[model samples]
Target chain A: MHTRTLAELGDALAAGEMSSEELTRHFLTRIEALDPRLNAFITVTGEAALEAARAADRERAAGRAGPLTGLPIAHKDIFCTDGFRTSCGSRMLDNFISPYDATVVRRLKSAGMVMLGKTNMDEFAMGSSNETSFYGPVRNPWDLDKVPGGSSGGSAAAVAARLTPAATGTDTGGSIRQPAALTGTTGLKPTYGRVSRYGMIAFASSLDQAGTITASACDAALLLEAMAGHDPRDSTSVDAPVERYADGLDRSLEGFRVGVVEEFFDEGLYPASAAAIETALDVLRSLGASVKRVSLPNLALSVPAYYVVAPAECSSNLSRFDGIRFGYRAENPRDLADLYKRSRGEGFGAEVKRRIMTGTYVLSAGYYDAYYLKAQRVRQLIAEDFRAAFAEVDLIAGPTAPTPAFDIGAKTDDPVTMYLNDIYTIGVNLAGLPGVSVPCGFADDLPVGLQLIANHFEEGRLLNVAHMFQQETEWHLRMPGGEFA
Target chain B: MALTRRQVESIANLARLQINEDEIPAYVRNLSRIIDFVDQLEGAGTEHVHPMAHPLNMSQPLRADEVTESDDRARFQANAAAVEAGLYLVPKVIE
Candidate 1:
């Protein structure tokens, strides 16, 4: 029961083999027993989950339940759940409970998916590793000493450990896919604006996207189907018709053209990671994909460009957190300036402060053009490179990160080393393309991820390709041992 | 392309972030390295490229203005360090 895919879970629910209440209890017990070790959840809404699960069971009894009707799914702490604390792993929002649901949460509730709990993340979804999370870091279920990639580390760790069959995550720059890569879970970041962003705690709005970390690509397809859609509430939400993601899982990849970015396989990448990616390419080749070496020369500039643009946008978005608002306020302030400074100083973690400072500096009067404007222009060049490359290929493939999961404190002090982890992924966000990290092979007893990237609004195709690959491999089926088994 | 320690201090002061003096060297080194890398963009030919801030160019639609939801200010402000009469109380701004 614990190892069944989401589709199987749905079938079981429909067949009365297990009630949603029973499934929810099973997961709740697993979370209670395991979360203390993983620190995956900041707030576990057990009572709400049980209540929602019971409602799903009632809906199933009435024969009105949707495909994911009774399946339990957790949300990253970034999404606002009306009655639950939606802290984006920041002390600034540690006590902030939203009054309304984020669009993704609302859609999931409407679909009757059980709300398991809120997973932990980096402060404001800013860091590459989960170490910057104010609640503490999430331990990779595969190896406790290794980090689960972040800011969606908690979501990836939870799903990998079988705390829940699937979990929601958000990526700005490589939050979802990178963490999913490290934890050996399937996570997808839909094209920009595909999922509405209203009520998602804003962090680099242009780059931020809601996605899922699940055990299989099929499970991700189901979760994506439930989550993707336009909402008038989010000004940037693309008004496009939602597709049946799970319906095309068994689609043949006979004519698929997989582009292997030559720049991605350059000197900086880990040798083991490079080998695993080559093996994944072979799998695609076996599935009849015509693989070719493509070059996106501008990708080399992505990390530097992303740092400027993301922080600049983040600096603007996070300005709303001043003590005058609903979040945390400073104590014993003699004046407004002191209040503002102390509140932000005390509330934000070290990494958050560092980013805020960097963002503020770059966007300041004198440096805006040299940094922010140049980054945006470079971003356009990178996007154009993808556009040109996609004209010759159907999809792009590479290693999600340069290496497998590193030790917890390995890159904590070195911000550049941490930023480099997103080198392969930042380009996807920069180009506004959809990308996924599927477990392909292991390096040094840790999981390595094969990254699949598709053109904008090509999520269905990407999922189909991933599902086809997953169908022939059992990597996604492997799980860590614990009470879950 | 390295930033001087004085420049780092000035930037930190301008941003209102209190960075310890000892940490300035590392921050300067790292930030300068990144800045130098991004500086490579200056050589790219972007003269004719209109800076694309967003992928899609569609304009946002407007709806009739109305309050769709509300939060209890008193309850919401309950977690704040200072508050008074359904408003967040900040330190006195007027001298």
Candidate 2:
């Protein structure tokens, strides 16, 4: 039952082979038995999940059920789940019990999906690895000693371990895709504004977009269809119609133009990972897609540009947590200024503070033109590069990350080294394009991912291409060996 | 391009984060490395390029001026650290 995909589980529920309650229990039991080793979940709402699952069963019995009815899923801690602690993996928000649900949470619940609980993430979605999480790092299921790429590490790890069929994640810069690649799960980041961000804790308002981490591309499509749409409350949410992503999953790749990003195969990429990506591209070519070398010349500037832009936005967004409102507050304060400083200092993790300080420095009066605006201009250049490539090709393909999962403590010491892990994935967020990472093959016995990027609002095409690739390969079906497996 | 300890303190003050004396040196080193890393952007030929603030081309959507939500201050303030008579309490700002 745990091995079944989300679609198969939905079918089983429809055919009355298993109740939603039973399915929910199966996953809850797995989480309890397995998550102690993985630490994937920050909070597990077993009682609430069972209640939601029972209700879903009643709805199905009453003959009013959606395709997603009773499907079990988890949300990254960033999304505000009403009455639950939406911690966002930060001590600042650990005590926060949201009064309302994020639009993503509301929409998924409306689709009859049951929430298992919130998964851990890098504190305030700031780090490339899960080590910065307030609750401690999530271990990759494939190799327990290896780090799960993050800030959506918990979600990706949970899905990879089959604790949940799918989970919701947000991507500002590879938070979803990088972790998914490391854990060998399917991850998707929709075009910016494609999903509502209201009540989804803001990290970098301009770059942050909510997406999915799932076991397979089909599961990602199913969840994305339910999660995508406009919300009046999130002014940035695009008012476009949500695509029938799952319906488009069976589309053929014949005549599809796939652009292999030349810059992505630089010296920074591990040779073994490159080999896996090249093999995946060959599979695409055999599927009747034409592959060509493409260059996003300014792509190398993505890391520097993103560091400035993301932190600048986060510094402003996180200013709201100043102890006057909800979130952690100091026990005693001499004055208002002390309250602000001490509360924030005591609350945010080191990585988050570093980002906030970087943002404050860059956006400071004297440095604004040289850092903030200059990075934004370079961002435009990077976007223009993607625009030019898309003009000649239907899709852009590359490695999701430079390499597979590293040892848990390997890159945490050096902030710049940690930041560079996101080099390949950040450009998609900068341009606000939709991208997906599908498990391609293994390197050093660890999963490598082939990333696919599509033009804005072309998630249907993105998922379709991924699903087609998944059909021709068994990589996505391979699960981790060891205790969990 | 390494930042001095004084500069790090000023930046921390501006961000409203109080770093303990022991942590300041580490912040100085890390922040300086980050700044130097991003300094490569200085070579990019971004002349005449518009600074892209957002990826979408749409302007802010406007709505009619009307009250839409019911009062839920009590519910919302459930997580607040301190409150009195429907007011959020903070360290006194004025004497």
TM-scores of all models?
0.96, 0.99
Q: Which 10 residues in a row give candidate 2 chain A its minimum summed lDDT?
A: A476-485
> In model 2, where do residues sit more than 4 Å from their true spots?
none
TM-score for candidate 2: 0.99
At residue A290, what lDDT does model 2 achieve? 100
- i-RMSD of all predictions: 2.2, 0.8
In candidate 2, how many clashes are counted?
0
| lDDT tens digits by residue: candidate 2, A125-200 | 9887899999999999999999989999999999999999989999999999999999999999999999999999
> What lDDT would each prediction earn against the true structure?
0.87, 0.94
Tens digits of per-residue lDDT, candidate 1, B1-95, equal 67778877776665555566676777787677656666777777777776768866558778888998676776566656667777767778997
- Which tens-of-lDDT digit does each residue in A312-430 have in candidate 1? 78777877877776777777887877777677767888777667767887888888888888888888989999999999999999999998999999998768778888989999998
Q: Report how far residue A312 has shifted in candidate 2, in Å.
A: 0.5
Superposed on all Cα atoms, the candidates' RMSDs to the truth, in angstroms, are: 1.9, 0.7
